[model samples]
Target: MKVILVFLLALGINLVFAYLLALGFFYVAEYFFGVCLTVKEVFFLWVFLLVVAPLIKLKFRSEE
Candidate 1:
Protein backbone atom coordinates (compact mmCIF):
# COMPACT_ATOMS: atom_id res chain seq x y z
CA MET A 1 0.00 0.00 0.00
CA LYS A 2 2.76 2.42 0.80
CA VAL A 3 4.58 1.54 -2.40
CA ILE A 4 1.43 2.06 -4.40
CA LEU A 5 0.94 5.47 -2.86
CA VAL A 6 4.49 6.48 -3.63
CA PHE A 7 4.15 5.28 -7.20
CA LEU A 8 0.97 7.27 -7.68
CA LEU A 9 2.61 10.38 -6.25
CA ALA A 10 5.56 10.05 -8.59
CA LEU A 11 3.26 9.51 -11.57
CA GLY A 12 1.27 12.61 -10.69
CA ILE A 13 4.41 14.71 -10.38
CA ASN A 14 5.70 13.48 -13.71
CA LEU A 15 2.37 14.24 -15.39
CA VAL A 16 2.34 17.81 -14.07
CA PHE A 17 5.92 18.35 -15.17
CA ALA A 18 5.14 16.98 -18.62
CA TYR A 19 2.10 19.20 -18.97
CA LEU A 20 3.94 22.36 -17.96
CA LEU A 21 6.83 21.51 -20.26
CA ALA A 22 4.46 20.95 -23.17
CA LEU A 23 2.78 24.29 -22.59
CA GLY A 24 6.15 26.06 -22.40
CA PHE A 25 7.27 24.44 -25.60
CA PHE A 26 4.06 25.39 -27.33
CA TYR A 27 4.29 29.01 -26.29
CA VAL A 28 7.96 29.32 -27.20
CA ALA A 29 7.43 27.89 -30.64
CA GLU A 30 4.42 30.06 -31.22
CA TYR A 31 6.21 33.18 -30.10
CA PHE A 32 9.59 32.62 -31.77
CA PHE A 33 8.77 30.76 -34.99
CA GLY A 34 4.98 31.08 -35.22
CA VAL A 35 4.78 27.29 -35.26
CA CYS A 36 1.70 26.00 -33.55
CA LEU A 37 1.61 22.45 -32.29
CA THR A 38 -1.64 20.56 -32.41
CA VAL A 39 -3.06 19.07 -29.25
CA LYS A 40 -2.03 15.61 -30.38
CA GLU A 41 1.49 16.73 -31.07
CA VAL A 42 1.83 18.34 -27.67
CA PHE A 43 0.48 15.25 -25.97
CA PHE A 44 2.97 13.05 -27.76
CA LEU A 45 5.80 15.38 -26.86
CA TRP A 46 4.73 15.37 -23.23
CA VAL A 47 4.62 11.58 -23.18
CA PHE A 48 8.04 11.35 -24.72
CA LEU A 49 9.51 13.75 -22.21
CA LEU A 50 7.84 11.99 -19.29
CA VAL A 51 9.50 8.74 -20.28
CA VAL A 52 12.89 10.15 -21.18
CA ALA A 53 13.43 12.81 -18.53
CA PRO A 54 13.75 10.40 -15.67
CA LEU A 55 16.23 8.24 -17.52
CA ILE A 56 18.31 11.28 -18.34
CA LYS A 57 18.28 12.39 -14.72
CA LEU A 58 19.37 8.94 -13.57
CA LYS A 59 22.21 8.88 -16.07
CA PHE A 60 23.52 12.23 -14.91
CA ARG A 61 23.19 11.26 -11.26
CA SER A 62 25.12 8.07 -11.79
CA GLU A 63 27.90 9.96 -13.51
CA GLU A 64 28.27 12.32 -10.55
Candidate 2:
Protein backbone atom coordinates (compact mmCIF):
# COMPACT_ATOMS: atom_id res chain seq x y z
CA MET A 1 0.00 0.00 0.00
CA LYS A 2 2.80 2.38 0.77
CA VAL A 3 4.50 1.50 -2.48
CA ILE A 4 1.30 2.16 -4.38
CA LEU A 5 0.92 5.57 -2.75
CA VAL A 6 4.47 6.51 -3.61
CA PHE A 7 3.99 5.35 -7.18
CA LEU A 8 0.87 7.46 -7.50
CA LEU A 9 2.66 10.50 -6.18
CA ALA A 10 5.56 10.04 -8.55
CA LEU A 11 3.25 9.53 -11.48
CA GLY A 12 1.39 12.73 -10.66
CA ILE A 13 4.60 14.71 -10.48
CA ASN A 14 5.85 13.25 -13.73
CA LEU A 15 2.60 14.12 -15.46
CA VAL A 16 2.74 17.73 -14.30
CA PHE A 17 6.33 18.01 -15.40
CA ALA A 18 5.53 16.59 -18.81
CA TYR A 19 2.61 18.99 -19.23
CA LEU A 20 4.65 22.07 -18.36
CA LEU A 21 7.41 20.97 -20.71
CA ALA A 22 4.98 20.47 -23.55
CA LEU A 23 3.36 23.83 -22.95
CA GLY A 24 6.68 25.61 -22.95
CA PHE A 25 7.77 23.85 -26.09
CA PHE A 26 4.53 24.72 -27.79
CA TYR A 27 4.85 28.36 -26.91
CA VAL A 28 8.44 28.60 -28.06
CA ALA A 29 7.69 26.92 -31.33
CA GLU A 30 4.74 29.15 -31.91
CA TYR A 31 6.74 32.25 -31.14
CA PHE A 32 9.89 31.49 -33.09
CA PHE A 33 8.61 29.34 -35.94
CA GLY A 34 4.94 30.31 -36.03
CA VAL A 35 4.10 26.65 -35.69
CA CYS A 36 0.57 26.25 -34.49
CA LEU A 37 0.37 23.10 -32.42
CA THR A 38 -3.05 22.14 -31.13
CA VAL A 39 -3.72 21.13 -27.57
CA LYS A 40 -4.30 17.57 -28.70
CA GLU A 41 -0.90 17.47 -30.29
CA VAL A 42 0.73 18.88 -27.20
CA PHE A 43 -1.08 16.33 -25.10
CA PHE A 44 0.28 13.56 -27.27
CA LEU A 45 3.79 14.86 -26.89
CA TRP A 46 3.33 15.05 -23.15
CA VAL A 47 2.22 11.44 -22.98
CA PHE A 48 5.13 10.34 -25.12
CA LEU A 49 7.61 12.15 -22.93
CA LEU A 50 6.01 10.84 -19.77
CA VAL A 51 6.59 7.32 -20.98
CA VAL A 52 10.12 7.99 -22.17
CA ALA A 53 11.39 10.10 -19.24
CA PRO A 54 11.98 7.18 -16.88
CA LEU A 55 13.92 5.28 -19.50
CA ILE A 56 16.09 8.30 -20.17
CA LYS A 57 16.72 8.76 -16.46
CA LEU A 58 17.64 5.11 -16.05
CA LYS A 59 20.07 5.28 -18.96
CA PHE A 60 21.90 8.27 -17.46
CA ARG A 61 21.83 6.78 -14.00
CA SER A 62 23.43 3.53 -15.19
CA GLU A 63 26.33 5.52 -16.67
CA GLU A 64 27.13 7.18 -13.35
Winning candidate number (TM-score): 1
In candidate 1, stretches whose alpha carbon ends up further than 4 angstroms from where it belongs are 56-64
* Candidate 2 residue runs with Cα over 4 Å from true position: 56-64
Give the TM-scores of the predictions, in the order they appear.
0.81, 0.78
Each candidate: what lDDT? 0.86, 0.86
Estimate the Cα RMSD of every predicted model relative to the unseen true structure: 1.8, 1.8
Point out the worst 10-residue segment of candidate 1 by lDDT. 51-60
- Residue pairs of candidate 1 with colliding backbone atoms: none
| Candidate 2 C-alpha lDDT tens digits along 1-64 | 9999999998998788677778888999899999999978988999998987677668888999
Whole-model lDDT for model 1 versus the true structure? 0.86
